[model samples]
Target: GFCSQSWTGLIAQLCSGISIVCWLCALTPQIYLNWRSGNTESLSLSFILIWLSGDICNLLGCFLTNQLPFQKFLGIYFCTFDSMLCFQLFYYRWWVKRRDSQLLRSMGFSDTSYHHHLAPSSSSPDGQPQAGTALLAANYNNPTAPDFFEGPAASGANDAFSLLDPSSASSDSPIIGRIIAWVCCGFYITSRLPQILKNHRRRSVEGLSLSMFIFALNGNLFYFSSIMLQSFVSPPGLLLASLPYIIGSVGTVLQDFTVFSQWFVFRR
Candidate 1:
C-alpha cells in the first residue's frame, strides 16, 4: 500500500525488495573468469558500452525523479562494473598489441588474430595451438569465457540506505536536495558523452573492432530496449531514458555502416 508513492518510488521499492545475494551471485561466472584469466580478451567492450549508456539514462532518471538512492545505486553499479571491465580489456588489448609488436620486432610473426589466446580444445606436438581457435584465453591456463559477463557491486559505505520520510532532516527544503541530486548525477554521467559523440561523428569505428560491434549490436539492443521500457516517458524521463538509447542505436548503426563499407570495399 505504502509502496505506490510514484513510479520511481514504486520501482525502487520493488527492486530493493530483493536480496543482494541473487544480484552478486549472478556474476559468479564473470568474476571467476577475471580472477583466473588475468585478462579480458573475450569480453565484449560493447557490452559495457551499452551498459554505460543505460547507466547514463539511469543517472538522468534518478536525477529527474528526485530518487537519490536509485540514482546513486545506478551510478555506483555502472562505474564499478564498467571500470573493472575497462581495466581488464585495456590490459588484455595492451598486452596483446604490445606482445605482438615485440614479436614482430624480435621474430617475424605478424598475425594479429585472436588465435594467440584462443587455441581451441586440442593441441599439437609441434608447439602449435590447435584449430577452432574459439577459446577466450591465450590458452587453457588463462580462460576468459567469464570475462564476457562481468558484475560489480556497491561498496559497504552505501549499504546503509536512506529511510523514507526521515525525521532527522527537514521535510521542507528541496533546494539543497535538488542541488545535491543534480550535482551527483552530473558528476556521474558526463564521462560517457564522448563515445556517444564519437559514434555520432561518422568517424572510423576502427578503434571499435568488428567483433565488438557484432557482440554489442545484438546484446546492447536488448539491453537498451529493456531500459527504455523500464522507465516512463516524461521530459526528464524521456531525456534521461530515451536520448542515450537513441544515441546508442544510432552509433551502433553508424559503426555497422563503417564496418560494412570496409568489408564491401575490401571485397571488391
Candidate 2:
C-alpha cells in the first residue's frame, strides 16, 4: 500500500509538472495562428475577457487563500499570457479593420458606394463590360468577394476556456477582489458556451485553431489529473478543497472537445 501510494503520488507530481509546462506554452499555437492569419475575428472577445477575468480571480485567489507559492506564480504567469492574448485580439481587430478600410479605399469603394458601383450595368458597344467595371464586377460576382474586400468581419469564436481556482475566498482576504474572483470562476466555467453555439449556428469553424484547442485539452487533462491525484494521495479534506479546480479543468476539457467536434464536423 505504501509503495503504491508513493508511486501514485509520483505520477501525480509528474502530471502536475507536465501540466505546468503545458500552461506555459498552451497559448502559443493560438497566438501563432492569429499572427499567421493576420486576423482574430474567429476568436471571441468575450471569451478572452472572461478568461482574463478568471485569471485575475485565480491570481487574487492564490494570494488570498495562501496556496502554494508555485500556484501563486502560475496565476501570475497565466495572467500575463492571457493579457498578451487579449492584446493580440485588440491588435488584430484594429489592424484588420484598418487594412480592410484601406483595401476598400484603394478600390475606390465605400460601404455605401460599393453596392452601387458593383451593380450589374448594361454591356458596352463592344459587347463587353467597361474596363474598370469588368474586374470589379467579376470580383463582386465571385463567391469570395466579400471576404477579400470586407475581411472576416464576422468570423470569431465566441467562447473561451480558463482555469479557475475556487479556494480563493478566505476570511483574511479583501472582499472586493474576492467577489470579483468568484465572478471570474463563473465566467471561466461558462465562457466556452458562446463559442460552441457560434460554431453550431454558423456550421463552420473556419477561424479557430485546432492546435490551440488541442494544447488546451492536453493541459487541462494533465492539470485535472495532477489535482485529483494530489487529492487522493493527501487527506480526505484535500479532495473537497480541490473540487473547484477539478471542475474547472474538467469543464474546460469538455468544452474543448465540443469545439474539436465542431471543427471535425464543420470543416470546409
Candidate 3:
C-alpha cells in the first residue's frame, strides 16, 4: 500500500525501519565497552552464544521460507554481530590473559604473581573499604578465588539475541520455518536468563551497560508496533503469520524490564 492510501502501512514500515536501525546499533556499545575495559568478564558468554544460535535459526528459517530480502539481510547482520561479540569474549577471556601470562613468564614471574597483580584490594590506601571490592572479594583469602572476583561486571548485555524478527515464517511457509521461528523465540527468551543469573549471583551490575538493554527495549517495542500496525490493516492472517515474532519481541521486552529492575536492585 502506498503512503497516501494507507497511513497504517506507512507507519508500520517506518516503525520497522526504526527497529532495524536500533537492533543493528544495539550491540556496538557493549562490544566497545568490552574492548575499552580490556575484558568481557562482566558479561555472560552463554548469553551471547545462545543469541548467536538463535540468529542462525532465524537466518535459516528466512531462507527456507523465502522471506523478504531485508529480513534475510537482518538475519545475516545479526549473526555477524553476535560473532563479533563472541570474538571479543574470546579475546578478553582467553587471548588477552594468555598473552599476559606469556609476558609474565618471559619476565620470570610465575602464575601466582600474575594473579596477585591482577587482584583488586578490598581497601583503599586511606583505609576505607572500596564500595564494590569488599563484597566481590569475599573469597579473597582462598587461593582459588572465583572468576567474579576477577573484576567488576560490565554494565549491559546485548538483547542481540532478540534482534531477529523470527516472524518471517508466514502462514504459507513450510512447517519447518514456523518450527524454527518458535525455536528462535525460545532461544531469545532463554538467552537473557544466564546474564540475569550472573548479575544476581554476583549481586552487582557494576560494569554492565543499562543502555544496551535500553536500546533493546526500544528496538523490541518498535518491532512489535510495526507488526501490530500491519496486522490491523492487513488481512487477519497477517497476525497469525507474525505470531512468533510478536511473542519473541514481547517476551524480550518483559525480560528487558526484569534486567532493568536488576540494575536498580544491584546498582553499585
Candidate 4:
C-alpha cells in the first residue's frame, strides 16, 4: 500500500517493511552479546554516538519534510534504538567498570595494583592478546588506565551507517531537508570506521556480534531497494528527496562487507 496499484509499489513497500524488521533485529545481537559477556570494550563508543546523532538528525529531517507516516515512524524507531544502544555502551563502560573497581577494593587491592592484577596475560596461546586483553594490557603500567578501567576514549577512525530521513515537503523549501539528509549521510557513512579500526587493532572481534552487522547489511540493502523503487516512478522532487536515503542505504554497504570480512578474517 505504499503506492497506488503498481507491482513495483507493492514490492517497494514490502522491501521497506523488511528493512524495518531487519534494523529492529540488528542491534539485539550486539546488545545481547554485550550483556552476556558484561563487556562493551569491543565496540567503539564513537560509533554509537555518531550513529545516534545521525538518527536524531534523520528524525528532525523527517518532521521538517513532512514525510510519510511510516517514514516518520521509521525515523523515530531508529532514534529510539540508537539511544538505547548509547545507554548500553555507557552502562558497560561506566557501571561495570565501577562495579569491578569496587570489587577490587573489597579484595584489598590498591589503585596502583588494580591494573596489574586485572590486566590479562599478554602471552596467549595464539601468541597475541585478544582485543579485550590487549585493551587492558596496553595501559597496565600507566597511572591512568584505558579501556576497561576508564570511561570511553576518543579514537581516530572513520566508518559508515544509515538512517533514512525522507524529505517530502511540498510546502516548505526542500533545501533544508536536502542539507539535513546530506549530514545524515555523512554520519551514517563514517560511523563504522571506529569499530573497524578497533577490530583491527585488537586483531579480534571478540565481545562483538556478527549477527548485528549481518542484519544491518540486509536492512540497508532492502532499504535501498525500496527507496529506489519508489523513486523510479515518482516525481522529480520525490526522486531528489529520496536520493539521500538511497545514498545512505547503499554507501555503507561496502563498509558492512568490510566488517563481514573482518568477522571471518579475525576469527583466528
Candidate 5:
C-alpha cells in the first residue's frame, strides 16, 4: 500500500530514500569513530550481531522490494550504499584489530582478539578482564574442545555457513540486490557478534554494548526467522541466519556465568 504510490510515487520513494541515505551517512560515523578510537568499547557484540543480522534481513527485503522496478539509478545507489555497509564491517574489524593491537601492546599483552586465537583466562593487565575473552575462553579453555573461541559464548556454535536465500536468488531478485545483502549483512554480523558476546561476558566495555546486544539479538533473529518461515526457504538463508545466532547464543550462555559490565565514557 505504502509502496504503491500514486499522487507522489517518486516523491515518496525519494523522500524515504533520502531518509535512509541520511541514516546511513550518520551510521558511517559510528564505524569511523570506532576505527578512530581503536575499539568498539561502547558497542555491544550481541547487539551489533543482532543489529547486523536484522540489517541483513532488512537489507535483503529492501533490495528485493525496492530494486525490483528501479534497478538502474536507484538500484545502483542501493547496491553502493549496501556495499559501503559491508566495507564498514571489514573496516570496523580492521579498526578493532589495529586498535586492539596497539592497546594490548601498550598494556604489555600479546593477544589477538579474533576467533582463531585461544588463551587461558586468569586476569588482565589493567582494567576488568573482557568477559568476551572469557566467554570465548570457555570453548577454547579445554584443549579437547573444537575451535569455537571468539567472544562470549552466546550461541557457542560458530556457524561458518551462508546459504543464500532462494527467494532473493530468483529472477525477481536482481543480482546486485542479492549480492549486496549477503556481503554486507553477512560480513558485518559474523565479524561483530563474537566480539560483542566476548565483551558482554568478559565485562569489557573497551570496544563494544549489552543493551544494544540484547535488543539487537532478539530483533535480528526474530526478523530472520520471520522471513525464513514465511516462505519455507532452503538451507542457504537458514545458514546465513544461524551463524550469528550461534555466536550470540554463546554470548548469552556465557553471560549466565560471567559478571556484569559498566558503561564507560567513550567506548564503541
Candidate 6:
C-alpha cells in the first residue's frame, strides 16, 4: 500500500509539472499565428471568450473547493494567459478595422459612398457584371471587409486597448464576477462545440493555428492524468468531487484532438 501511494504521488507530480509546461506553451503558437496573420477573424472569438470565462471559473472553483495549492496556482496562470489571448484578439480586430478604414480613406472612398460607387451596374456586358469584378467591388465596399483579409496584408502593429472598462473591474461587485465565473465554467466546457461545428461547416481549418490545438491536447492529457493519479491515492469522495474537472479535461482533449485531426485532413 505504501509503495502504491508513493508511486501515485510521483506520477501526480510528474503529470502536474508536464501539464503546467504544456499550458504555458499552448497559447504561444496561437499568439504567433495571430501576430503573423494580423487578423483574428479565422480564430473564433467565441472560443477565446469562452475559454477565458472557463479559466475564471476554474480559478474560483479551485479556491472555493479547496483544491491543491498547485492546482490553484495553475488556475491563476491559465486565467492570466487566457486573458492575454483575449486581449490579443481584441487588439488584432481593432487594428485590422482601423487599417481598413485608413486604406479606404487613402483611396478617396468614403464609407457612405464607397459601396454606392462600387455597386455592380446593370448596363454591363450581357447586362451582367463580371463575377470577379463584382466580388472585388463588394469586398471593398463591405462594412466588414476586415473579415476577408486573412493574409499578410492584414498584419499590423499591435494596439493596446482594454475590452472592459477599468472602472468596471474596480467598481463591479465581486459577487457578480464570481457568479459569472461559475457560469463561465459551464461555458468553458461547451465552448469547443461551436469551433468543432465551424470546422465541419467550413470543411477547412484554413485560419486555425495547428500548434495551438496540439499544445492544448498535450496540456489537457497531462492535466487529466495528474488529477486521476492524485485521486487514485485519495479517498473515493475526492474522486467524486473531481469528476467534473476530470470530465472537462478529458472532453477538452478529445475536442482538441478532433480539431488537430481536422487540421491534418483539411491541410490537403
The candidate scoring highest on lDDT is 3
Q: What's the distance in Å from true for residue 143, model 2?
A: 40
lDDT of 1 by residue, 126-187 (tens): 22222222111000000001110111111110111111114313443233333433333332
Whole-model lDDT values for every prediction: 0.35, 0.51, 0.58, 0.56, 0.35, 0.50
The C-alpha stretches of model 1 lying farther than 4 A from their native spots are 1-16, 19-21, 24-28, 100-104, 107-268
lDDT of 2 by residue, 61-105 (tens): 555555545555666766776777777777766654556556888
Candidate 5 lDDT (Cα, whole model)?
Answer: 0.35
- lDDT, candidate 3, at 263: 82
Per-residue lDDT for 109-212 in model 6, tens only?
Answer: 78655434433344433222222121000000000000001110000000000101133223433334334333543564567766777666666665566766
Which is better, 4 or 5, measured by TM-score? 4
TM-score of each: 0.36, 0.70, 0.76, 0.76, 0.31, 0.67
Q: Which candidate, 1 or 6, would have the higher TM-score against the true structure? A: 6
* lDDT by residue for model 3 (27-75), tens: 7777777666765666777777777777777677657666545556666
Give the TM-score comparing model 5 with the true structure, all chains together.
0.31
lDDT tens digits by residue: candidate 5, 1-268: 4333232334323333332233223234444444455333334444344434433443344434332222223223433433444455555455555665677668877655432342224354333433323211111110010111121111111112112324433555444433544443344434444554555455455433243333333333332333333223224454444444334334333442332333442233
Clashing pairs for model 4 are 158-193, 159-189, 159-190, 159-191, 159-192, 159-193, 160-189, 160-192, 161-188
